[model samples]
Target chain A: MTDTVMTEKSELPVHMRRAEFDPVPELAELRDGPAIARIHTVVGSQAWLVTRYADVREVLGDQQRFSHARFLERRPPGMADLSDEEIAQARAGNLLAQDPPDHTRLRRFLIPEFTVRRMKRLEPRIREVVDENLDAMEKEGPPADLVANFALPVPSLVICELLGVPYVDRAEFQARSNRMLDLSVPPKERTRIARESRAYMAKLVAKAQAEPGEDILGMLVREHGDDLTTDELIGIASLLLIAGHETTANMLGLGTLALLKHPDQLALVRDHPEAVEPAVEELLRWLSIVHSGIPRVTTTEVEIAGQKIGPGELVVLALPAANRDPALLPDPERLDVTRGEMGHMAFGHGIHHCLGAPLARMEMRIAFPALLQRFPTLRAAGTEPGFRSFNVIYGLTSLEVAW
Target chain B: MVSDEQLLRVRADRDVCIGAGMCVLTAGAVFDQDDDGVVAVLDETPEDIDAVRRAVANCPSGALSISTGTPAGA
Candidate 1:
């Protein structure tokens, strides 16, 4: 066993070194003993890693004690890497970073557009989008990166359609959106991307306002009218466009990777298209793509699982860890498509749960089955690629599949 | 002939559902948008089990839930 060093809190690494999604080794180690332990972040912040199932659920479910707004207020140390203007932009666009009334208000504006009812109408269109990408994949032939060909565009097209974003400018939008997710990059670059994306979204929304369409951005303008300022509209649009595509894209590629790795489960899905509903849930649970829950701050001094959390401390809820905890899931590690686990925190819990979940699920259910059906002999081409380093969103760099 | 199996009603708390449009995309027969874009349950007791399951799975907010209560065959 490697020797455990009790070092100063300042010396801890802020970011995880191992690929964020590959937590098997960590799970094995934690399962062997204590579920919770102290881990140092590269930012020199001390965070308690809650690995047990019960603790994570308890922490996430209790909103009063654990506040999201307070956590966003306290910048994780080493954020000095960012410039003042960039920091200001982050603060301005901190809708998801807020709690309660503010969060409720912002979330209210977004919730209506993302409903299951609304998405159902778009099903055929989403299928068309999937088919379009698959058609490209087929044309491009084997050794093509699924990430580039299939995974990325499925959601990108969907979001573009939803928000009335011009498909012509998607390349620029994707580049800027990706830069926004890069935490390791200097703050200036991050801020620039954030600003550029917001500006582009604002332009899209403005265009929608001038000439409204049946899309979500048009609807938002029509509904809220004067209530939404230009910046807020841009902010909300940017959030939806980015959230709409990036996370779901990661899931599509990663979920496909997971299924490819487990041929037995893949065979089950292939054999039983009827099982797609439960299979998606099981895949979400097994992968837990979004590695950590949205960070919440301690509103008042509170104790969680016997640990004393001081007031105003930032707590990062580990969703993947929670979903995999043995206490909640019987085997925890195994991937059973039919496993009737209550539900997983892949989309998160409580009021702050993912707004784009329905669309993401729809994309997965449609894409996975269609792909399997279209290419019965689909298999990975060459050695599996590695995952991206530091970005909160977890996905393989590329998945080359061939029949 | 309606089987003895209880019919499942899927309802969405309008307060929770963000118009991700996913539910409709996944199972259109069960859910649809009103004139105002809020999700409304069209067929609380969907005849198809697969459609019902899709509606339940597609709900992003977890607002849509399935309930089993027998209604007198009308």
Candidate 2:
């Protein structure tokens, strides 16, 4: 594979080129050419892009053969816009970026709190959160942004409650989180936001320590005690806060938008409440929000789909591409809520699968129907909705809906 | 309260589990890790239907289940 160098198009990070992915069809055309192609990232870094379904899954499933933490040690291609300190903060070891032993240790501290049983107890509250947001949208009436009103708030509120942070300061968290993820922001600004979030989380954790609440932070403080350092607590809390809300928020907005566009499927979900289970699976597949699966670095020489990848090469498992692979799901592009999509990679496959998936599914199952039932005439404000420009996630910037 | 026979049966192939700990966090009574940090089944049949459902939902490895009667829990 020959390396092709190209000038950077815009100052924006490589991750922000979602609209330019129109070449995805062309990328697919070359899928079989070289399973491991050396391509220039939007930031001009040389990285290996794994395109096909089998290879993508291979990279994600084999932690022994591949490592996630190594990518953080150096500046990731698209993150060139980040300052050294910003990159350092962003690369800090949270569950998503770690592997094996350390990954196991950090993840154990969180398992008890994220349990299905716990999330089940949180379901009614999640519904309440959805309802309150929807109620506010109703009061505001027509041409309301689902992203700001319904989509963003429900998950944000739920995560805040789960982490024991007062929802009163949610606006601060939301602002900082959004800026932290913004590829267009200056590196220093992003770094500042990252530090601010950690500090905010540290304060929140301290509060939970002094007077324990029913949240995850309280549980960690009570169980791990000195075993959990303040930085670790902040790291864990920040990771959850970001992952818990950002992904679900996008799914809720995008999934609802998809349903509204496909009335028959919307009718199916609205008619049969029990269908929420299967519908959620289909929505996850259709939306495929975690645009690409998390990145992994090869630890050893491995052959995936008959193509050999050497150690130290970066591998990105494209979940969106995999979920839609014709080999796995028939008519992969169609959004069929009742379709048998049991094993789609929407929440990912194997270890490192989305931990908050149950809560996410619960939120959507309740949010979508409640949304439709609450406003029978609910429809997008216009023909086209604004979308966020990011490759890691497919998000609606503003989904204005009116009854 | 759901009977053990009515509860869901969720099991993960211990060999494939990478210890993401999603199940334990989502449903502790149903899933726990052994001293080796591998996921171990605590209750093949959960007593609460809600808990069983939650257990199934939280299994990141997709190693948990819910019973539909007949064979009465996997």
Candidate 3:
């Protein structure tokens, strides 16, 4: 197969470029062809975009050819003066930033903590968290911004309990994570937030080291302290904290909006509690809260979809497009909760697939039903609740609803 | 939900399971989970064969499988 490199320096839109609920039309058009297409990065660089469902599995599965570390090494365009120490500090501990051996090792320690059985213990607590927030939403009455009162707090409180972060510190951590992920923020400001967030996590790491509670961070400190570093602990905690809340919170907000827009579907979820699990699955696939996947770099000459992508070229997978690929299922665009499981990439795939998937799934299954059941007459309060397209995680910033 | 007419048998590879809960979610009557989230086959012959088959296919870890009691080369 011949290489389809985009050597031209013309202005191409970023792969993640999208509207409120869908990928831009151009991405679907790209799926028409084979192998690859050109897409711009957030930092004004070009990379090969893989849109098909099968090809995505190939790339994410073959970590030997596609290196996560090389992808992390690509700095934003403006960061010309970052010291090597600062660079290492920033990348340390985040599982998405590491490749095999390191990625394998870190994930092994985390697997047990996220197993379905382990999450079951937290299910009752998750129910309590969902009910507590619903209580507040009830006290606040109709016309509440679901994003603030219901969507955000459920995951925030759950993750805080899991990682041993103080619930009181959520406002601070959420602010830092939001700024850290927002592309519109100046790169320098984002970097500053990254540093501050790490510093804050470092203090928590220190405390965990001293007291060693039963939380995830403390478990690492007690069991794997010799095996892991302070920086690694901080990195793992920071990644889990940001990821644990942001992805689910957005799914809750966006999924609620999607269901409200289609009240027939919402009724299925509200009336039949058994329907809630599959509804959550369909929502994760349809909404696809994570718009663009974490980019991967080709470590060696690799052929994907019949295109010979050379070593070191960046490969961006359009996850929203791939999940909606017609080959995966019939009538890919339709949202049917009865459609058991679509095997979507919403929680991603391969060795680096979201470690917290079971936890995320449980949280959504519990939260969505409880929220819908509590406010049976819930409807959109305003015409325009905004979307978080600019942030790394796609979600509604605020969703106003009235009961 | 298991019946005498059905010949399907379900088995789980616990070590290979990542506990995505896809199996339990897909075939709730036939499959449940342990405290560690590894799948436990409560019933081998589920009344809903299609849901059980889909659960096997959708296991990201490929931990679940099915077998039928038939001669190999019949």
Candidate 4:
């Protein structure tokens, strides 16, 4: 056991690395055999990184063997001082932090609202949201940070409307959301910001409890108030608020930059409206905005790609490698918008697959084409867009673009 | 009349559906969403069986399924 620990320790680099916009070069080497690597995280923890596509699916698909709730066994290392009450409050209703029965229960309630049929009803409203952002960007003229002016606001407003959070509260929540997902932010600060965000949602939840609106929060209050507690409401609202925007916003920013880099592909998406849907898929697969997914812990000793992972061990899914795996797609690294039937794990896989995927996809399908059509000569400004490397969710902080 | 095994019947598991909507995107004729966005089966024997199969495969939540036991005359 001592020798095994030493070997694992030696395998890790001094500072564990994160993937960039593209799949890391070393990942290709790691994918072929012994697909697991010992890696460090921003939180200063070591995890077994599952690099190969098949292995990632195997690990993520089997929640019983690789438990999402195992990480909740203790407060984060620095957060050990947090009281049990505080910890319980933190975990309250965040679905990603849960396993089976609990996760399934909460998810079942929200599923109806997220169904493709439901999102289709939302498309017209989502389209309006996209167009309004585009109009503002057009008026703002060239040299605007796409991330700020366009990418962020579209989803931000859509989610705000969905949750019945007053649109005026966007800046406050956006700030808290940013800090909450930022790994570079000190853990204490992240925790504090998280608390603030939840408190803000709690206020909205209280209001919804008193008088339910035609929004998701309102619907939950009207329908499932008996089943759900206030903490759970806040947790659900907070997760949706943060997740609904941060991911799709990044995809918009990074996706635009990626398209600009590949004009041939961009032309197809711009000129052919039908191409938008598939382009979104290719972009989602290529960019994979979410970095290593929510880490899972092994409930039992398991072997993946001939490498053995012991019980209670943490496993990280390298999504970019999996999406670009030759086993999943031919010429896996190339950005082919026309590529049909690309079954990538960008939204993840299994029971925890992104609930807002349809909404995110619809937003993109509307936003990208509208942006291109509005600015016929849209191109990147001289300023290089800043990539958020240290953040838990990968995306561009600001992308300067001009027409 | 098609054999029972050959009959294609599609159903949406409303409880488990997270509404990724890949089904409607793949086979719109066979699926539609209700007012709240829960999937409502539009047609059990869709005009395009291949597209229906593709939709079933792509549904992220496994909310969609096909059964062959139900006969047209039953």
Candidate 5:
């Protein structure tokens, strides 16, 4: 199932760099030097980059001061303008795009579906899903691309089953979602792909509207159909699909590679059952996959790290940099799963935290242990693992591994 | 008189809670969420202060706060 490693080598934004363990020097300079930095973004003007852990925490905690949905109102220079209706449509049921009470109303409908206890109920099914992929990879024998065979498909199928997305259309939606996030691709093209994604989701949503199934989509339709618009439904379903697809897949691929690079850590995660949770936490902190949650707009005059910014200035918090800041832990550079450090903004912070966090955590906790237990001889296949450094989320396009 | 540090308690603002559920994942004894995903402070002064601290630290909404010597939810 493995496609070749992606070799696309476009320049990464200043917040990101090509590295395995730590956020590289580009962001390290920002985190250490000052409370705030003015960084040039690919799609936007110069924005304040809050990389210090404390400062990022402060900005993320107070939505009154740093509002992300407000920032999108004034689009970046190169982007096409969205009309009032278009903007509303775009923000509808989009958790990141809408602030409360709209965001709260939308998120509340889906929260019961993703609670920790609810996710615990999905454990057996998740184990079965991980095992099914592992079984397929085993049947195919050594030198398999873990990204395609295991990392990508496990989460893809889980979300598909849960979101009522057809498994057969995984290829189409995966491609669209991947390209939608690929920064190397033209913005216009990405927008086109995004529309196609919404359209595809709209069909599934329509079917759910007519006859709801037991999937999360069905639950939404049955419970909150009257409360939500069809567009909002489509937006919500499609957002989950894209978010679930690669965030963990990349973490799985890149995490496996990171552990493989550090055999001692890999052994601990594989051998000790108690080690799994901390290992996953460290991997998330170390990888810190998603670049920044979103660009936040200061709603009023603010003081972030003593830099008084006027109202309406754009603010971006670097999760990768914040995770690796010395203030987060004593030595943030090392991938020490045993560090017992828990607060990594890999999932972002404040009202806009990652909704799929529990689900992501469960999949990794199950997949990593089972993969190692099944194939203790697992080693990186000679092929160099490829990383999607240019994407919004940092991860490997392919991780060729063999048992 | 007991020192303020002798007591540990946690408080959750349901209005501010975004239902991320990190609290339960981190310190289930101290927190849960209602049906709509507002945080439910289970044992506000549970013995697991460390776990509650982690939950407070990891919470995205900053809905949960820990203080010493004050009863949570008072």
Candidate 6:
């Protein structure tokens, strides 16, 4: 209804992209009609936005045509003098910055650690992590900012533990990730944040290099010491550390709030163990916290959903809208935990699908149910929930709740 | 049906496998990931057929599939 076109390239691209837990109405209308539209991106680049379920899948599934690696090939303005090799080294082991053979090489080493068996081994620890946070919340009593007390810390702690980040570093690390994910922050400021974040991770990488510990970083060093470069280690660790926490953290915060808004759904997650699995899947699909997925660069000229695109063009997937498309499933807009396995694109699709998805899923499954069970009477209180509109990740900045 | 018969056949096309581990996460008994993040089927006819179905549905790449096969351990 309203002007959905982001007319100016310089305008803040994060403008009005929401309906609380749902995407803005304009996005749905786009998904229905055009299926694809050209829009100005947050970075001041014009890109193709593919919104419908099947069209988004086409982009995601065909990594050959839609290259994930080239998406990050743009040299940072500050580092223009750096050699191509140096720039390539910077993106070395980051999964999102890679594709196929390279992605397969580094990813294989990490996959075993994230396998369901590994997650199963981590389950008790996850349950313990969930219990520890819930215990603190219970002790703190009501009027707690769930974002600070529960949602943020649960995933933050879990990821830190998994990635071997020092618990003490979390305060500064969280602050950096906050700035990094928030698109509203100026590009120069974000570049500085990225440098600081990389420097911070580089130190940890060195520590693991000296004496590999039992964490993911340690495992990489212990197993692939001869194979990986220092930058590769840093790239992999930083990606996991940021992705691991930010994604699930928002899902936890916003997901808890979503259930609070729907007491009926909240009860299903808390009271019924059978419901927890489906509920997590449903929450992931419904929320689609990563509103717009990472932009892909076309490797060659290609047509998508009948739209033609030349080589080197940018293509963005409307993940939240795609998940909510009526064509994806029946009553797509409705938040129904009973409906699971509808093949939602929240974790995305194709080869570069989220590597931490299993971990994210496990964390939410444990955290959401535990939160509801701990505070049976949980409801919003104190501060009005403020949505973090600018952040690449969609979530509440603070969700004050009382039991 | 005999002990060696292929029962509860599950086919995995490693050609398309990106090794995201969705299948392994969804149906642990029926699917696993090799070191290189390719799909590895541990059980074709797991007790939890529904879980296997979910795994097939959840696969980011359409690499995993389930089909009828002969009985197991007859």
Q: Which model scores highest in TM-score?
A: 5
Per-residue lDDT over A59-98 for candidate 1, one digit per residue giving the tens place of the 0 to 100 score? 7666788887776666545556556755544544346776
User: How close to the true structure is residue A322 of candidate 3, measured as C-alpha lDDT?
Assistant: 85
Q: Candidate 4 docking: what grade?
A: acceptable
Docking category for candidate 2? incorrect
Clashing pairs in 5: A350-B60
Clash totals, every prediction: 24, 13, 2, 3, 1, 0
RMSD of each: 5.6, 6.2, 4.0, 3.4, 5.1, 3.6
Residue-wise C-alpha lDDT for candidate 5, range A140-231, written one tens digit per residue: 97889999999999999999998999999988999998998888788677667767777798899999999999999999999988888998
Reference-based TM-score of each model: 0.81, 0.82, 0.88, 0.90, 0.93, 0.91
Candidate 2 chain A lowest-lDDT run of ten: A14-23
DockQ of 2: 0.18
Q: Local distance difference test, per candidate?
A: 0.71, 0.70, 0.81, 0.80, 0.83, 0.82
* Interface DockQ per candidate: 0.25, 0.18, 0.29, 0.48, 0.73, 0.48
Ranking by lDDT: 5, 6, 3, 4, 1, 2
True contacts kept of each: 0.42, 0.23, 0.29, 0.62, 0.79, 0.60
Model 5, position A303: C-alpha lDDT score = 81
- Which parts of model 5 have CA positions greater than 4 angstroms off? A1-11, A76-84, B1-8, B67-74
The list of candidate 4 runs beyond 4 A from truth reads: A1-20, A340-342, B1-19, B32-42, B45-47, B62-74
- CA lDDT for candidate 1: 0.71
Interface RMSD of 1: 4.7
Give the per-residue lDDT digits (tens) of candidate 2, residues A167-283: 899889888877766556665666567678877887887887898777788888888867876667777888888888788888888888888888988888888887777898888
Ranking by TM-score: 5, 6, 4, 3, 2, 1
* Poorly placed runs, candidate 2 (over 4 Å): A1-23, A32-36, A75-93, B1-74
Residue pairs clashing, model 6? none
TM-score of each candidate's B chain against the true B chain: 0.76, 0.64, 0.79, 0.83, 0.83, 0.78
Candidate 6 structure quality by residue, lDDT tens digits, A1-41: 12346656545453227868878787787778767777888
Residue range with the least summed lDDT across 10 consecutive positions in model 5 chain A: A1-10
